[model samples]
Target: INDTFGYQNYFGIIPIFDKENLLGTLVIELKSQQNDYNSRFPELLIEGKLKSDEDFRDYSFAFYKDNKLYSQSGKFTYPMVNTNEFEGVSNNVVFTSEDTNNVSYSHAIRKYDNSKLIVITKEKMPYVVRLATLSFFFLVFILFGIVIYILLWIAKNLADSNAGWFNINRYLMINANKILYKTRIQFSVVLSVVATLLIVGWTTFSYIKEEYLKQQKDSIREKIRKVQLSYEKQILNLGLRVDDTGELQFNQFADVNAAYLNLYDINGKLLLTSLRKMYDYGILEKRMGPVAFINLSKLQRSEFLNPSEKIGTFTYAAAYAPIRNAQNQTVAYIGLPYYANEADYEAKIGLFINTLINIYALVFVLIGVLAVFLANQITSPLTFIQENIKRTKLGQKNQPIVWHRQDEIGLLIKEYNKMIAALEVSATKLARSERESAWREMAKQVAHEIKNPLTPLK
Candidate 1:
C-alpha cells in the first residue's frame, strides 16, 4: 500500500496479491478539509502582526503547495511561481516583481514540506526612502531655525519696549553681549574644529561611496566575462551554434557566486535565462536591453555596463558582453544583472560614520579643553598688566614690571615700565621744588621778625 498526500485530500492504494500475482487493487480516499481550521491560525497570526504595524497594513501573503496556490491574504496581484530552486541555509529566497499594471511587489519566499510560503509588500527603493528621510530632516531643521529666529526677533522687540514679560530675555541678551574675550576665543576654536570635522566627514563618506560603487561595477563586469567564456565553451562542447536559421538550445548554467545570467541571440532577443520567472511574470522584458544591444551588437563593443538600471524605482547594475564562436564570429550576447544590496552598503557607511562621529566627538571635547587652556594662557599676562595699571599712583613710588621674553607682552611691559619711571621722576621733581619754596618762605618770616626788633632798638 502506498500513502500519498494531496492539497485537499489523502489517498491510499492497496494491492491484493495471490502468491506474487496481483489479483485486485483497492484505493481509499479521504477529504482533508482540516485545512479550514489550520488556515485560520496563521491568518489570525498574520492579522495580529498587521495590526501591530500600521506600515504593513497594505502587505499581503500566500501559501503554495507544490507550485499550486493554496491560500492567500486578500487579492494579491504579484505573479509568482515556484522555481524549484533551493536557497542558502534558510531555504528562503527574496524576489522583486512587477505586474502588467506596473505595480511592483517586494516579497520573500520560505520553503517547507515541498511547499513554499510567500509574504509580499508594495515595492520601495532604498534610495528613494533615504532621500525622503533626508528631506524630512532638512525640513525639520529649517522649521526649527525659523521658529528660533521668530522668537529672537520677538524678544528683541519686547526688550526694546522694556516689556516686563521679556525681562529674562533682555537680561540674557545683555549678559551675552558681555561675554569675555577669552571665552569667545575658546568658542571660536571649538566651532572651527567642528566645522572642519563635518566637512572632512562628508567628503570621506562621498569618496567611500564612490569607490564602493566602482568596485561593484568592476566585479559585475568581470563576472560577466567569466560567464561568457564558460557559456561559449559549453556551446562548443554541445556542438551548437547560435544562428537565426535554426533555434539553438543552450544548457542552463549555475554559478557558485550566486550570480544570474541571460543569453540572447545575435539580434538581441532573449533566448535563455536563469531567472525565467522575471519575464514569465512580466517583472522584466523578454528582449535584451536596448543599451546592451547597441553596445554588444551594433557598436561591436567587447563589453557594456549599465551602472544603474531601474525597474519600478528599484535600481541595480547590469553587465553585458558578446559571446563568440571558434570562427571569431559573434554568436550570442551574455548578461549579468547584479542587484547590489544597499542594506550592506548602508550598514557599512552608517557604522563608519558613527565611528567617525564618536572619534570626532572625543576630539571635540579635548579641543574645547585645549582651547580654554590656550585662551587663559594668552589672556593672563594682559590681566596682570591691567591690575597693575589700576593700582598705579602719581605721588607714590610705583613698581616696574619685569618680563624676560621679548614677545608682544614683553614689549608692552617695557613701555609700561618706561611710563612708571617717567611718573616717578616727575614726582621727585615736584617734591624738590615744593621743599625749596617752603625753605624760602621760612627764611623770609625770620628776617621780618629780626628787622622789627632792630628798628625798635635804633
Candidate 2:
C-alpha cells in the first residue's frame, strides 16, 4: 500500500509468489503505531513470497498461525486471515526478489512525506540570530559615538566663541568709559546679568530639546519595530513562499505590506533589488558605490540594534535599520522617513534669541541715550557758569546769569551776583576817597604857588 497522505496506516499487503503469481494475501498488522509501518511492509510481502519459482507457480500463501505456516490460499483465490497473527513483525523489514526475466529490483521501504523534506531543508540551513544581534549592537555603538563626538565638538566651538566675544566686549567697554569720562559700571553689571541669564536659558533649552529629541527617536524606533514585527509575523503565519532565485521581493498579506526590499553582496554589489527607480538612475547608482553602501550598512545595523539611532537633522527625524542575512551580516537597510514637529519650537527659540539680541541692543541704545542726556544736563549749567566767570574776569560784569530754576546752578548764580554787588560798592567808595585826596593836594599846590609869588614881592 502506498502511504500517499503520509499517515502511517497499513492496508492489506500483496504477496507475489513469482513474477506472474501475484496474489492478495492476509491482513498486515502493525506491531506499533509509533513506528512508520506503512513505509516497509508492502515491499517485504511482495518480494519475500515470490523469491522461489516453484512456490510462485503453486502460489500457496499462508498466515503464520501459532508459530506455524497455515495454507490459506489453497481454498480461496485471495487469502484472508486474522489481522492479529502478523503483530510481531517490525516495520523495518525489507525483501529482495527477482522478476520473470530474473532481474533484481529494489524499492525503498520508506514513507514519502513533503513535510519531512521541508524539515530536512530547515535543519540544513540554520539562522545565526545571536551573531546578528551582536553585530548590530557593535554598529550601533560606533554610530552613537560619532554623534556624541560631533555634538561635543560643536559645543566646544560655541563656548570658545562666546568667551572671545566676552573678552572683546569687556575691553571695549573699559576704553569707552575712560574716553567719555562716564561711569559705565551700572551698565556693565546689567549686561553681565543679561548675558548670564541668556547663557543659562540657552543651555537649559538645548538640554531640554536634546531630551525631547531622544524621546521622539525612541518613539519612532518603536513604531518601526512594531511595523517590521507585524510584517514578519504575518509572513510566517500566512505560510508565504517566495520564488527560488533569491530575488528581493515583497509580499503583501491581509494586513501587512513591505516595499523596497534589496539585497547586496559582501563586495557591495547589488545582487537583487526591489527599490523604486523614480529618481536619477545613473547618478544614484554611481553615488551609491561601495563606500556609500558600507556607510548605509553601518547606519542600518546601528538602527537595528538601538532602533532609536537617528539619522539626518534633528528637525526631521529620519532613521534606518539593517536587514541581516542568515550569516549575521548586514545585507541591506530599511529607513523610515519622518518630519519632526520641532519647527515651531525651533522658530520659538530663534525668536527668543532674536528678542534677546534686540533687548541687548535696546539696552545699549538706552544707555547711550541716557549717558548723552545726563551729560548734557550736567555740562550745560557748568558751561553757563564758566562763561559768566570769564565775563567777570574781563571786567564786563554787565551781563548777569539768568537763573531759570532754583537748583545748584541757581544758587551758584545768586552767590556770584552778591559778590559782584559788594565789589562794585567797594570800588565806588575807594574812587571817591582818591578824588578827595587829589583835590586837597591840588589846593595846597595852589597855595604854595601864591606864597612864592608873595615872597618875590617882599
Candidate 3:
C-alpha cells in the first residue's frame, strides 16, 4: 500500500461478482497513524541490544537496512564485513573479531529476515586503561605467599629451636648434581625458599626497570634541550618579532614529530601557528605566559596519540625557552616538545614485563615440584636417626641405624652407633669382674669350713 500522495487513508475498491455476472461494489478504508509504527520498528529491532551487558547497554546499537547501514550509535566501529561469515546465521549471533580500525571487539549481531535489516553491538575490553599495573598487584600477592610459607616453616620448627635455646638448624636447600637428584631440606624449608625467591627476584626486577626508565627520561630531556639551544642561536637574530612565515619555519626546525608548537610574544599573547590544530589541546591555555615558563616542571607519563602513526602514551620532556635580541630584553618563547619511539612500543614493553613475571612464576613452580622428591631424601634418614636414639635411651635392644651416605647426616648417625657399641662393651666387662670376685669369696668360705673340721678331728 504505497501512500505516494501522503494520504492518511488507504482505500481498496472491489467489485462483487457472481458466476459470470456483476452484482454490486464493495469498498474498504484503513487509517494510518502518521507512520508511528514504522518509525518504532527500528527500536523494536534493538530490543536484544538493550538486553546485553550493563556496561554496553547505553548507546551501543547499529541499524542496517538490508546490506547497508542506516543508523548507528555508540562505538560500533567495525566495517567492511565479509557477508559470508553471516551466511548461515538465522538467529542472533555474538562473536569477537578485529574491526576495520584493527581493534578487537566483542560483537553481537542479529538479522531480521522479514525487514532485511540488522542490529550490531560491539565492545573492546583490551582498550581499557587500568589505573595501575596488574603485575605490581601480582607481586604484592606473591609477597603475601612468601610471608605465609615462612610463618608455617617457623611455626613447625619453633619447638625444636626452643629445645636448645634457639640453636640454628642446618641450611634448608636441595643438593642436586648435574646428572642426578641427591638431597634436599625438609618440605617446609623448600616452600619457604621458593616464596623468598619470587619476592626478591620480582622486587629487584621492578626496581631495575624503574631506574632504567628514569635514566631514559633524563637522556631524552637532555637531547631535547640540546636541539632547542641550537635553534635558539638562530632565533637570536630574528629579535622575536617574527611573522607567520617565520614562526612556522621555526616550528619546522624541530626534528621529531612534536605534540605542539606555538609562539608567544613578550606579552604572552598567542601568535601564528597551525590554525586547524590550534588550541585543540588544553595545554596552550596555561602555557602562554612567562610564569608558565618559570614554573615549567616536567609532566609525568602524559598520554599522546599521533593519528598519522599509532603511538601510545609517550613520556615526553617539554621545554620552552625565551628568545631575546641584542639588548637581552625578553621577546618570545620557542617551545619544542616531541617524543620518539617505534610503532607498538608500548605494547612491546608491556609484553616484555609480563613475560618476565611469567618466567619468575614458572621457575617457582618447577622448584616447588622438585622440592617434593628432595624433601623425602633428606627427611627420611633424619627421622630414622631420631627414632633409634629414642629407643636406645629407653634401654630397648635395637639394631644398628641404616643409612648410606658420606654427607654430614650420615657421619652423625655413624658416630651415634659407635657410642652405643662402646657403652654396651663397657657394661659387659664390669659384670664379668663382679662375678669373679663373688666366686673367689665363696671358695675361701668353703676352704675355711673344711680346715676347721679336720683340726677338731686331729
Candidate 4:
C-alpha cells in the first residue's frame, strides 16, 4: 500500500507470497514521506505466519522466520526474504530499504533492453523541434538572402556598365565624325591613334576594375560566412526554453550580424526590420519599398523601370543574400552595404566622372583647336595660290607670287611666272610684226603715188 499527502498521492501494493501463504506485501507511496498511523501499513505476514516483529534480520524486512520476512513504513510496507536465504527475488527488492523513518518511496521499473528513462519534467512545454526547425530555416533564409543580393548586385553592375559603355561609345563616335568633318588627311592618322588608345585604355581599366570587384565580393562573402558561423554558435550557446503556454522562445537568436537584416513571413509580410529611414520632400518613405527587398532571382531577371533615373548614387559596391527556409525557399533578404556609404560613393564617383568629363572636354577642345589649325594650314596656301591665278587670269600679268617655302605650291608659283613671261614675249613679237606691216603699207602707197606721176611721163 502507498499514500500521498499535501500536493497529490498514489498507492500500490504487490503480494510477495503465493495465494497459499499470503506472506509478503510490497507498497509504494506517492508524495508525502511522513510515517504517521494514517501512513503506516496495517500488517505483515510471512509463510502463513502472522509476523508482528518490527525489526527483521534485514533492515528492509520487518520480520523474518525460516528465510521469510515482513516490514512496515508510512502508507506502504513490504516483506521479503533476505538475499542470503533466497537469491532470486531477494537481489531485486534489497535496494528498496528506507533509512529515514517517514520517507516515502516511488517505484520505478527498468526494462531489460537498457533503454533510457525519459523524465518529462515540464509537461506543458512546447516542442523544441519546432524551435530548432525555425532556427535552421532562419539561417537558410539568411543564406538565400545573401545569394540573391549578390546576384542582383552583379546584374545591376552589368547593366550600369553596359549603359555607361554605350554612352561613351556614342560620344566617341560623334567626336570622331566631328574630327573627320574637316577633311584633313594629315590629322586622320593622329585621330585614329587617339581613338584606339582611348578605347584600349578604357577597356583595360574596366577589366582591372571588374577583377578587383570580384575579389572584393569574394572577400566579403567569406567574412559574411564567418560572421554567420559565429552568430549561430552564440545562439546555440544561449539555451532555448519553453514558456508556460507550450511555446518555444529564444531571446538571443533574434538579431543578425549583417549590414542589413530584415525578417519577413512566407507571405512576404514585414515582420521585423533593421533599416535606416530617410524622408525628403513629399516622399515620407525614401528607402522603404518593395525594390529595397532584394529578391535575387527576380532582380536578376527584372528590367528596370527607368534606369536613366538615378537611384541616389553608389560606388565601391553592395551585395545581397536571401533568407530561406529548410525547404530551400526564400523568406527574406539581407543586404551588405558597401564600406563606403552612398553619399561617399556618389561623391567619389562624381568627382571621378567630373574629372573624366573635364579631361574629355579638354581633349575635344584640343581636337577642335587642332582641327581648325590643320584646316587653316592646309587651306591658307591653296587660297593664296588660287587668288593669284585668278588675278593672272584677269590680265594682271606683272603681278608676282610671293611664296616662302620651296614646296609644290612654290613650284606651281614658278610655273605660273614662266607662263606669264612667255605670254609677254609673244605680245612683243606681235606688236613688231604689226609695226613692220604698217611701214610696208606706207612705202607701197608712196611708191604708187610716185609711180603714177612717172607712168604719165613714160
Candidate 5:
C-alpha cells in the first residue's frame, strides 16, 4: 500500500486460496513506530508489530512478504516474525552495531515462528552528554565534600587543638598524664597526613577523568567544519551582502538553521545575535581588537570558557568563523555554538569531584581508625612505665614495671629497679653507722662526768 506520498509500503500480503485457486490477496501493513523497521518479503505473511528503543528517524522500517520487498513502516505493525533474537529472549535486546543497520542504544524484537521485526528507540548517549553528566556529579561531590570536610575540620579543631584554649594551660595539664589522650593527639596528627594524601589523590583522579572525557575532538571539529561549510554558500551569497537587519533573501532564512548565531562587524562590534541563552553577552559590549579573546588563530578557532564563578558552572566550548562577502573580504565574524548541552560538561566535572570527595571521606575515616590503633600500640607501654615512676616519686609502693618484650624499654625498667635497690641498701647502712657513733659519744660523755665528780670529792 502506498501513502499519499506514493511510496511503496511494507505490506505483508497473504494470498487466500480456494482449494488451489487464488481468491484474493490479504494485505497487512507492517510498521515500526520507533526505529528503522527493516525486513524483507512481499506476500504470504501475517501482521506484526516491532518493539525497540531506537529513534525512528535513524533507519526506515521494512518487512519481507514471500521473499519480496514491500512497503516500509516507521513502526513495526505487521506479522511474519523471526524469533531467534526475540522469540526466546527474556527481555529487550541491547543493540550493538554489529547486529544493527546503524548503532542503536536499545531495541526490541519479537519472533513469530520464522520472522521477526526490529524496533529501535534511541541512539547511545553522545560523549559530551556523558562527560557533562560525570563532571556535574563530580563537581557536586566536591562541593558537598568541601562542606563536610569543613564541618569535620571545625569539630576536630575544637576537640583536639591545644592552642589558646582557656585562661590557663588547663587542658594540657588535665590531659598530661592520660594515656588515651596523648595517644589520640598523636594519632590525629598522623591521620591528618593520610587524609590529606587521600583527598589529593581523589582530586588527581577527577582531573584525569575530566581530561579523558575531552574526547572526540577531531571528529567534533570535523562536524563543526562540515556544518559551517554546508551553510557557507548562504552566508557568503546572501547573509553577508545584507546588513545586520537580515533583510536579504538568505539572511532571512538563517534564524532557524544557525545553532549559535552572532554577527560582528569588521570593526569587531557585535551587530546581531540569534542566541538567547547568552550569559557572557557582556563580552560583546566590550570592543574587540583584531584578535578575539579566546581564539588561537585570530581567524578560526573555538575554546572553552567559564564565564560564571558559581559552583557547577557551565564551561562552553564555542567555535568562531569568518563571514565573507562577494569581495572575499572578511566582512563579519560569526561565532557558532558547538555544544548546546553545556550543562552536561558541568555535570561531568561535578560528578568527578563529587566521587573523589566521597572516596576521600571514606579513606579519611579508615585512616583515622588505623591511626588510633597505631598510636595506642606505640604509647601504652611508655604510659604504664611513667605511672610507676610517678608512684615511686610520691613515696608510694612502686610495683616493678614488667614487660614481655626484650626491647630497650624493658632493659630500662630492669636497670631502674636495680638502682632503687642499691639506693635502699646504702641508706640503711648509713643509718646504722650513725647510730653506733651516737652510742660511742654518749659513753665517753658519761665517763667524763663521773671523773669530774670523783675529783670534787677528793
Candidate 6:
C-alpha cells in the first residue's frame, strides 16, 4: 500500500461486536508524507516527550521490535543491543557499551501478537559534564577532610580534660598546645602537596587536551587536502567532470583513513559521506552545515576549521576545504571530522593521577617519620625539666639541671638552678631562727617557775 500510494502508512484493525455478537472489522490507516518511516518510528515511539524533559536531555532512546534493533534516536545509543543477546531473556535486559561508558536500561512489553516492544534508554554523558561531576566529588572530599580535622580537635580537648578516657587519649595527644603541632605539620604537608598536584594536574590535562585537538585539526586539514588532490587526479585521468564523479572511488579513499569524509556539491548539497551509518540513524543531516557552507562558498576561503562541531552529545573538530578544478573554479567542498575519545583521554589522566598518588604516599610516610623525630627532639628536654621541678622540695638539697648547650633550654635550666640554690640558703636561715626562738621560750619557762615558788613560800 505504501509503494502504491508513494507514502508510508500504518494500519490498525478492530473487530466490530454488538453485545458479544461479532460483526465486521473496522480498519484505520495513517499515512506519512515524509516517506521516512524508519526515522519517524523512534520519534513517534517517544511521543516527543524527550524534548520537553530537561532531565532526559542527556538520554537517547532506542527501540527493538521483536528482538531486532529497529531504530535509535542517536547513532551511538544501544550499541550492545543485538538479536543474539535477547535470545534467552525472559525479562527486561540491562546492558552497557564496551567502547564507551554508556549504559542501557531495557523495558520490554509483550505485544498481543507475541512480539515484544523494547524501549531502551542510554545515558549520554559528555566529557564536560563529567568534569563538573568530578568537581563535585572533589568538593565532597574536601568536606570529608574538614570533618576529620574537627573530630581530631575534639579528641585533643578530651585528652586534656579530667575524663576517664583522658589517660588513654593523653598518649595520643602528646602536644601540650591546643592544636597538636605534629599533626598540624603532617596535615599541612599532605594538604599542600595534594592541592598543588590537583591544580597542576588539572591545568596540564586541559593543555594536553587542547594541544591534542589542535594537532587533530591540523591532521584533518592535511587529510582533506590529500584526499582532494587524489580525487582531482582520478577525475582528470578518467576525463570526467564534477557531475560525473561516483561514490565508489570516494568511499575507497575514506576506508583508508581514520577520519570520516563528507563531499558536498557547489550548491552545498551533500553528495556522499564515508559514515553512512550516521545518516541512516538520523545522526547527521544530508547537507553542509550552514556556517561551513557560508565560510567556504561565500567567503571564498580555501579552508575553514570548526573546532566545536557537535553531533548529539559529542563534539569534534571538523575541517572543510574547497575542491577546485584546473581552471581554479570551485567544483565541490570536502569535510573531515575527528572525534575526541574522552575515555582514552581519561584513562591517561587516571594513570597519571595514580602515579602521583603513589609518589605522594611515599612522601607522606617520610614526612610523618621526620615530624615524629623532630617532635621527640623538641619535647624530650621539656619532659625532663618538668619531672625535676615536681621533685623539688624546701629544706632539702634540690638537684640542678646541667645542660651543656647555651640555647633557649639552657637559659631555662640556668634560671631553674638559681632558684634551687636560693631555696637551700633560705632553708638554713629558717632552721637557725627556729633554734633561737626555742632557747628564748625555755628561759621564760624557767623564770616563771622560779617566781611561782617564791610567791608560795611568802
Best by TM-score: 1
Report each candidate's C-alpha RMSD, comma-separated, in the order given. 14.3, 34.9, 16.6, 35.6, 14.4, 13.6
Compose the digit string of candidate 1's lDDT tens values, residues 263-374.
Answer: 7878888877656557776878888889889887788899999977777776777889888888988888888876544534666787677566556655665687799999
Error (Å) of candidate 3 at residue 168 is 22
Best by lDDT: 1
Off by over 4 Å in 5: 1-182, 194-317, 324-328, 338-342, 383-411, 414-418, 421-424, 427-458
| Clashes found in each candidate (C-alpha, N, C closer than 3 A) | 0, 2, 0, 17, 71, 0
lDDT of 5: 0.52
Model 6 lDDT at residue 187: 62
| Cα displacement (Å) at residue 129, model 6 | 28
Q: So what's the TM-score on candidate 1?
A: 0.59
CA lDDT of every candidate:
0.70, 0.47, 0.53, 0.46, 0.52, 0.66
The TM-score of candidate 4 is 0.35
Off by over 4 Å in 1: 1-179, 239-252, 341-345, 440-458
Model 1 whole-model lDDT (C-alpha atoms)? 0.70
lDDT of 3 by residue, 122-159 (tens): 54544222212454455568779999998876777765
Model 1 misses residue 226 by how many Å? 1.3
Question: TM-scores of all models?
Answer: 0.59, 0.30, 0.42, 0.35, 0.42, 0.53
Candidate 2's C-alpha runs over 4 A off are: 1-283, 286-301, 304-319, 323-331, 336-375, 383-451, 454-458
Which model is ahead, 3 or 4, in terms of TM-score? 3
> Per-residue alpha-carbon lDDT of model 5 for 349-387, expressed as tens digits?
666666655555555545656777777777777888778
Candidate 6 clash pair list:
none
In model 3, where is the ten-residue run with the lowest total lDDT? 301-310
lDDT of 6 by residue, 153-268 (tens): 77776777565465656745674457755566656666776677678767876887677656656766787788778766765666333343566666766766545688888888
